[model samples]
Target chain A: MQTVKMVITGPFSSGKTEFIRTVSEIDVVATERKISSEVEKIKESTTVAMDFGRITVDDDLVLFLFGTPGQKRFDFMWEILSEGMLGFIVMVDSTRPETFREARTILETFKAYAPTPYIVAANKQDSPDAWEVEDVKHALRLDPEVKIMPCVARNKESVKTVLLELLYGILAEMEKN
Target chain B: MALKGNLRDFTITQLLNLVNLARKTGSLIIEGPTDVAQVTFRDGKLAFARLGQTDSSLATILHLNQKITAGQYRVIKERAGKMTDKELGLLLINAGYLSQEDILGSVQQYFIAIIRQLYTWVDGFFRFQPDLMPPEDKITVRLDLENLIIEGSRQMKEQEQLQEEIPSLDMALKFSERPGTNLRNVSLSVEEWRVVSYINPKNTIRQIAKANKMNDLAIRRVVFSLLQAGLVQLARPEGMPVAPVTSSSSSRPGAAPLPVTNKEEQKSLVNRLISRIRSL
Candidate 1:
């Protein structure tokens, strides 16, 4: 089977684990109760640091999906974790608009280290008051060619739609080569 | 066999069973890793998922393939139990244990867990959509009333005469229109199309590669082409297949109003960064 590596990089509790759970073809084996209470007082548990899964787009190919730590302190670790990585799904929360810069920094870092393609999933599109898709793009200053999809990370439909977009982005990148 | 209420009160496996039986649509929101994940379902079939804010510069995820110890995983859960997903992702990323790519990968997997559990929870007791918002972190999803009493009695008699109708893989595949695609004329390399054909909407790439001797990388390239062309898709795994007859839910009085908790948490860490920015 041909495999491509993709990573799920986002803030803590931004549905990294859940995203992995829903898109992977097989059942994901998660470490139950993987968290610290003291941390809980500061944050949420459920999927503390990271999660893993894979997607089969067809009979011959599979994407090795990776999720990273949700905390900023873990940023230094990404260089090591992202070696030979194909692309990334930058999970964003439209509910909170202040995080635009943080997302940009990570993308800039990627550009500096590796010229990889990426797609943005403006999650929580289900929320009644989510920022407009255009507003998000304007805020993030993303490229028009980049596929930034509207989605509710909780819904498989929305998730699938975005996956197709990112996969396309990956293919587009490969085509450029 | 029936499925019941939302998964806030049930385990992962339990939730998936409910999804399969109801053939419901919408998304299940799981508050894991400090973020709210929405996994969409149609006719109780798995659809798609995403994480983080598409608009933000701070938005990132884990590599998804890195395996963690139950203990370290516990620390994340405990920390995220209190903090918001954004807070947690930033915390870990800054802490230097995970990368943005890695987090994205994990976010995808966590979503799969919610989808899988929907199958396990479908035992005729409760009925609920994982996508709907619950009144509390752990609220009971009241089942449909009329069917609960009626179906309970009917099950005893029906079991004697009924043989469980199992759906074939092809039938389940029908849930996705396959985009009614024709792969011809596309600029596919022999290696790329070989990989693309393997990335069926229904199976995982790992599963496909296991069946064939192809390297996962080649297949991934093709899958990307199909995805770009809108011919195939990737979704969380729905539970085991069942017959055409969907399940029922119990009737509960109108749901109580959910408590107001600030969905967004304080960006203290980032706040510090922001403050530093302003000072600069």
Candidate 2:
């Protein structure tokens, strides 16, 4: 069977795992551990290693979703997971402005890794305090051409929309070549 | 719901930029380590600010600016106790004690000073209360935030550069092994010398910063200069978490790079993925 890979990355607790789990047809394989740092106060556990999920598009095509570990120390795994991926998504917790810088860093790192199409998923858009997608784009200093889509990661429809937008970006890149 | 977050994540500059760009009218209440500040904005312009429990009364401000004498200040404080700042200002203007320009200028200066003090506060919790206006009893002024935003942006850029150079405070520092460029030969500032004395393989930069009573920006600046001078080098502190590893190359070891796909193959794959997602 032919398979394609897409990596999901962002800062700590930016909903990488949830994004993958929502759309993955198979049960996600997550290596989550109880967070021991001060971050534990925010969430009980975090992805320590990586989260794996899969989608069988059809009998002839399949897609693999890889979620990178978000903490700074786990940064080494980003390059490993990003290798040979067709595209990627940089997720941001829309309610948290502090994680914006880290999100930008991750975006830049991934861009440097490969000349691939990508999109920024502004997760947690359902939160009342969540920043607008335009504000997030401005804060991240993203180009106007780069799509920053509002996303509620837990919603299957929203996750599907983000994935479809990314596929369109890839298709455009292919047509350009 | 009110907009709120830690200052460490969204900075004052970013907050100001958002307010300016969005033309927001609100009160941004910031709770610093030891004090709380409330700065009100009108259509993105700075309208008023109060820091902690400081005296921000109109009479006090006028007196501080020498627009009113000490005797007048005391008399106003004792007799105009129940009168609002607007009422008191009108009375003063009618009695020829001060002009409108005098009162507004002094208040604006005071508010700007409070905002300048807030620029130094890197760690705090801030919330923006939408359409929260200053008390009617207090005086307010509309001062353009463009200049303040520009200055704050400059400061933020400098701080960001320093952080980029020294990404982590958990890492320790050691004297460089170069035969030349010793500390004795270099002329170091008092602050630099203070930081230099604390450099060691076991003492993390955070410890050094705490010992010297320096904040994150201050400590990063000192360490960045030392690194530039080749006087110190970063080292992982004993038993500390591993520092981030940055890869200069496209792919890291142990991860086999994917073979490049041709345009036709990529297009077909994307078309198939799109079709699947659209169907979902």
Candidate 1 stretches with Cα past 4 Å from truth are A29-43, A46-49, A57-60, B1-280
Displacement of the residue A21 alpha carbon in candidate 1, Å? 1.3
User: Which lDDT tens digits does candidate 1 get at residues B171-243?
Assistant: 1111225655666755767665555555544666556544555433334444445555666555443464555
> Once superposed on the true structure, which residue ranges of model 2 sit more than 4 Å away at CA?
A33-45, A127-135, A138-145, A171-177, B93-97, B157-269
For model 1, residues A25-48, the per-residue Cα lDDT tens digits are 667644334456564343445543
lDDT of 2 by residue, A37-140 (tens): 88644888889889999988889889999999988878888887888898999999989888999999899988888878899999999999997787787778
Look at candidate 2 and tell me the lDDT of residue A112: 81
How many Å off is the CA of A99 in candidate 2? 2.8
The ten-residue window of minimal lDDT in model 2 chain A covers: A35-44
User: What are the Cα lDDT values of the candidates?
Assistant: 0.52, 0.88
lDDT at residue B178 of model 2 (Cα atoms): 87
- TM-scores of chain A across candidates: 0.82, 0.98
| Model 2 CA RMSD to the hidden true structure, in angstroms | 6.2
